[model samples]
Target: MARPTIYSDDIANTICEQIAEGRSLRSICLDEAMPAKSTVFAWLADSGRDDFRTKYVHAREAQADVLVDEMTDIADDGSNDWMEQKNS
Candidate 1:
């Protein structure tokens, strides 16, 4: 027997949107009662949604870059690490 079709593009798009909104994959899967995480990831990775994946990856990278810049600024100011002199 042939396997069932578990996902539609519309549904996949909705799930991807939720993920892009900062929702956790586990949470979306649980809420949607999806069969498996791999199923959702596969749907996202499909060729039809390549644009979505590219946009999502770029957004995440931008967020990471902002965080790194903030950390670097703090470290340069010596506020990220400080050592106190101890008397023996």
Candidate 2:
């Protein structure tokens, strides 16, 4: 007999939460207890359940927001002459 898959609702939700917090799937898969990258991709590929798929997409968008925020902070640091030169 083959071993049953060990995925669970709690694990899925936790992954979604991490995604919402801006953690990439690659990083999530790096954790000791997290699912494998293939498993997570399988979840994203399954059309029957929109829950995980939707969460994953939204989480990617959240990561973009994080990137923009970081860029804004760096641009506003006021310690650089790059902006002055650009505006000149």
Candidate 3:
């Protein structure tokens, strides 16, 4: 019996990209004619690239939140100063 061929990084990346784009794993596998769903998952898990992607996404979201808070503070600063003057 012939052994099944292992998928390459390019193929795995395509699968991951498709998933990130909202394609279901079953749909991708069926469209791509992939041998098994587990194979795609294994590729993603083994590559260690997903971990970095997750970390990057989280960091970017945190940065955005911080920027929004800073902008809010700047916008409120004048109002706060006016209120203090009125109170005094």
Q: After superposition, how far is residue 28 of candidate 3 from its true place, in Å?
A: 0.3
In TM-score terms, candidate 1 sits at: 0.44
Per-model TM-score versus the true fold: 0.44, 0.70, 0.41
Tens-digit lDDT track for model 3 on 1-88? 3222386655655655655554556787775445467665565466566763564345446556666777888887876564335555
Q: Pick the candidate with the highest TM-score.
A: 2
Candidate 1 residues 10-75, lDDT tens each? 665666566555566677666544436777667557888677577657645655666677677877
Worst 10 residues of 1 by lDDT: 1-10
The whole-model lDDT of each prediction reads 0.62, 0.76, 0.58
Model 2 misplaced regions, further than 4 Å:
1-5, 78-88
Question: What is residue 3's positional error in candidate 2, in angstroms?
Answer: 13
Model 1 local distance difference test score: 0.62
Q: Which candidate number maximizes lDDT?
A: 2
In model 3, the worst 10-residue window by lDDT is 1-10
Steric clash count of candidate 1: 0
